[model samples]
Target: MLYTPAPLHIPDGFLSILVSVVCWAITIIVIGFAISKTNKALGEKQIPLMGVMAAFIFAAQMINFPVAGGTSGHLLGGALAAIVLGPWAGMLVMTAVIAVQALLFQDGGLLVMGANILNMGLVTAAIGYGLYRSVAGQSKTVKLTVVGIAAWLSVMAGALLTSLQLWLSGTSQLEIVIPAMLGVHALIGLGEALITVFALAFIIQTRPDLIGEGSESAKASRNWVFAGGIVSLLVVLLSPLASADPDGLERVAKDLGFLSVGQDAPYQVIPDYTVPFLGETALSTILAGVVGILVVGVIIVLIARGMKAKS
Candidate 1:
């Protein structure tokens, strides 16, 4: 069986080179600002916690839940990251995770990596975090409700952007792609919302310090070992149970007759999140997921440490 990344994530050849280049330029500019912001705002002690959070997000994203009508959607993690690590630092963490997913795990194309990061990282993180901030100072139930709504909105926002990019690339018509993408993503967004709320509630109970002061700054934690271990186990164990149904984006693409637009990457180290030696079995997928978690964790730690050093 051929392997493709969950969520499709704007595979290669679906976007024009011009669009890709523009997305890359914008991503670089925004991430530069994020790096500077994070450097000034993040504490030295929070570096390791950032790594664990990244790992947790990475693992959570691997658990794709089934939506209605034979479709699935996974956590995008932008809002969750922003909620836990502030918008700037969270964006940086998300960018690092997506970059590793594309470059090392082959979950997204290198060419379309910029677009993926733009859709899933910058836009979602900014909008979700902004909405979350707007609803602050409410009751816990209200805040969680608002977080749910923001999470849903964030997924829709990314879906809208994906549709627009696909339309611009001549993959699908705006009339057809927009509604299809939005419709499926609307449901997907619910899953994102629930997961975000649940995860946040768990953290609030177990480690409120990670949520920090005002979502713009965080308190440090030395207990990341337990959190990281739990996340690592989840990635290794539950990833094999991810739904086989096409994700929201892929379902829309197939239903809209644009699925053929995707092309294989020029090269892949671990194509479709499967280990080469393991040969497309459940074990291969689990091993790949574990490796991805570790890679993302380490990269986030290094990035956080660098930001701390610069500060």
Candidate 2:
């Protein structure tokens, strides 16, 4: 059988229209603020960094590693982004990644895109940056520890927010959904934490200036950008090896009997990360992932440049 990766974000029909609209309003307002903040503070070096971060996150998200209970999980990248790009630009990069996932890959629902961005992008970036900032001037070990905690908490926060949204949409009972969602996600969060910590550790060792406040002082270098693009492409090449198990939300929805309610995307474009003509082959997934990373990277770069120009 062809392996189909389960849905990674909230799909249409999973939440009520009212809830979606509310999420859209909140996301729009926050994103607008993010744009303003980024425009004012964005540095020349940070612009390309945002693009690289978005591309890396987009590619990394395609590789869902197993997390137990027949479930799988992937890096959210918000913590890493926030730590590297700061909160405002981090939000923009994450927003670009999620938006592209929904629009180009059909990985998430268009109508529920706002909720997905809010949960996975804004909330994660905020929490990650908030907690990480607490360790300013700390030792490297201390900083890594805090980053791991922040990343784990970010996943938990995303899970909690998702549960609330499901409850508010009347998709499941609050009592059952909360434990179910959080329980499974606790394991998933570990995976998130590990990936985040390891990625940060690598950055700190090879390019210490890329982390946190150091990013502002770092000079722009084409070599770093080239290296980042290579890493993202390497990740995409491994896309076919990603576990095919249902992700946290998908498993939760299935267990709670609401899986059937998830409506399909109204249209298809590289649906399921497979080029239609390629017919579910490994090459198809890799090709689609490459396209995703390139598209998200360029989009983020363009957005960052625009913000910089305005500033």
Candidate 3:
């Protein structure tokens, strides 16, 4: 069976060429600015931080937790990334991760990569962080609450934008898709909130130096690197247990009878997140997960290092 590129992202045949082009245009514009801002904001030492963070996000997204109605959701990583790395840098990291997912891992559509990045990266980094900063204030307790709320709302906002894109593409009616998408994603959003809050809290406690202008000591940074390794290992070991149920968008598409509208791309290097020549096995999945994490980390590190050089 031909699968849509990513579980939650809008894929190939689901969107019209026009909608895809528009999404691409907007993504390009925003990413250009994101690159500029990240270059100016991040320093040489911070590159490794961003690199490990991207790897952690990539690995974390591999585990899909079960939700209601046989739907599942994974970490969108926008809110967590923004809170840790600052918004603009987070946006660039997400863009790189999504691009690698599509190009090398084939987790998302190559053609619709812009839309995937825009929805999952730009929207969350811009609107989600804005909401979080506005409401979080300075108190640590308030910040935690606001991050959770902002993370939940960011998932919903991304869902709403995706639904609107589908509606515009004539894949489904706005009224029908809107309610279905929002309803399923509401539960998914809760998962996002809880996970984001817990991760943020952990960082605050263990690596408070990583936040804001705080400096990370050599030991603390090493600990973070170790943590990233552990997270990646966990993703590889636990991904086999990820729920087999359809994710939020896939579930909505099935319910709305628009699932069949998805089109296969012209070519696939590693389609459906599966590694070719390995067959469908636990080993293959783990290998693919590891490969994706490494790819995302290496790409982001190279980008950051290149920028640091230029500066």
lDDT of each: 0.68, 0.68, 0.66
**What value of lDDT does candidate 1 attain over all alpha carbons?**
0.68
Candidate numbers sorted by TM-score from highest down? 1, 2, 3
Worst 10 residues of 3 by lDDT: 237-246
Task: Give the runs in model 1 whose Cα sits over 4 Å from its true position.
Answer: 1-4, 64-73, 215-311
Q: lDDT for model 2, on a 0 to 1 scale?
A: 0.68
lDDT of 2 at 142: 87
Instruction: Please report the TM-score between candidate 2 and the true structure.
Output: 0.65
* Candidate 1 vs. true structure, TM-score: 0.65
Can you give the lDDT of residue 43 in candidate 3?
A: 74
lDDT per residue for candidate 3 within 11-101, as digits (tens), equals 5777766668778999999889777866776678767877787877788876677766776666778878877776777888888778777
Cα-based lDDT at residue 206, candidate 1? 94
Ranked by TM-score, the better of candidates 2 and 3 is 2
Off by over 4 Å in 3: 1-6, 63-73, 135-137, 213-311
Predicted candidate 2 versus true structure: per-residue lDDT over 79-195, tens digit per residue: 788777777788899999988878776777888889999888887887677666545567889888988988887776777778767766768666677667767777777988898
Candidate 3 RMSD computed on C-alpha atoms after optimal superposition onto the true structure: 18.0
